[model samples]
Target: MRLRGRKGIRETIESQHDLVVLNPAEWKGRWAERFGNEKPIHVELGMGKGKFISEMSVLHPDCNFIGVDMYDELIRRASEKARAAAGREDGSAPDNLALALFNIERIADVFDEGELRRIYLNFSDPWPKKRHARRRLTHAGFVRQYVRLLDSRGEIHFKTDSRPLFEFSLNSFADLNIRLRRISLDLHKDGPAPDNVMTEYESKFYEQQMPIYRLEAVIGQEALAEHEASLALAERQP
Candidate 1:
């Protein structure tokens, strides 16, 4: 079933010069001088409905952004937002944003190694089952992917309300030798970071009196941690 709820879903995503690939096989090493803004690239993994990156891309004019998600329906909406951005008068102010339909597990293949300056891991699945811990985006397996695509100085900004997931991510960072910085177990206690991007799930979590946990981890090498359990829920089939 196609996920619904964007104003412009029917418009074409690709220009005459390129193809909007829906399959993961076509995604590897594709990013280049493709966007209008030539500055460093920032990306969001699991960009649901294009809310966070779309707003962030609009706000930050100088930096380019690419949002990667596996859902074709979601990318279609994200593409529409990019097409809308193309006509803006200011060049630095997000003349465009890019979208791709690919799995997060294929992070390195999605772009050339060390190509991304920053990554946003917003409300990724907790995968609560002990057996499924390996599937979490912050898990050792996923961290390896991030390590490959992220620049040496690049950081992964994460936000989640799940205590288990937060603890797991911190442990993953430590075990993997990933540099943990700007640590925040609670987002509301300290002043909200000016650059933080909020997703739809984040807003819902806020309204439910959940304490939002946020952190920044830089790429590094550390021993991987052992998973206590696997995700009990069925993985969302792509």
Candidate 2:
């Protein structure tokens, strides 16, 4: 399905200027100041339509949330939904939520070292073609970048309906010696917990009785160093 082109998306975003930051690069390394608090920051990459992250800001008031997506239209849609959800009865979005428009590959440019406490990847694009393996968000290179942006004990929580993508991500994390925990192959069948906030896609997939794979991975210093060393060694090889 093609996305509906949003007219005046720029104006729409500007209207919710506090809720959406159009130029994420300018705020790099100083996101905490922008949030006006020292609260732990969490981000959701590919946060389609903003369901998960918006609800997250409401649920965890102490933690700031940033939802990143590449498309202007998607960000516009997400901005509206999130503002509506976070708004007071009179109409005001939460101070803890913000949305960024940028490709995930430039994530490092938007966040500095150890600036994030958690990262969420929900129903991300599978990028199934073998030739596009490197483009998958869970690819080694991306994982390495995530590790750099996360503080000690920070974790990445991932969920997907694609078996191949889930399996590939599992292997990718293992190869980096990252610690994996709380894995579930059929999330809905296992039953939703109070803490399980479903995204728009997650809800639809659950209604369709499709299995959802989920896991939490921790990238400790040792694991990150090991992965970097391996990459270095591979680079020096003929």
Score residue 129 of candidate 2 by CA lDDT. 97
Per-residue alpha-carbon lDDT of model 2 for 1-238, expressed as tens digits? 2577668877877777778888999988899999999998999999989989988999899899999998888888887787788767856778999999999999999999999989999999999999999999999999999999998748899999999999999999999888787798898896665589999999999889999999988675654565567779989999
Q: Which ten-residue region of model 2 has the weakest summed lDDT?
A: 218-227
**Worst ten-residue run, lDDT, model 1?**
222-231
lDDT of 2: 0.88
lDDT of each: 0.70, 0.88
Candidate 1 local lDDT, 1-238, one digit each (tens): 3576555443444331232445534544545556633477788898887778888877787887878888766777665555455545542224446676787777666677877778899998899999998889999888877778776556788999888999999998899776666687778654444667678788777667678998888562321111111122324334
Candidate 2: stretches off by over 4 Å: 220-238
| Every model's TM-score | 0.76, 0.90
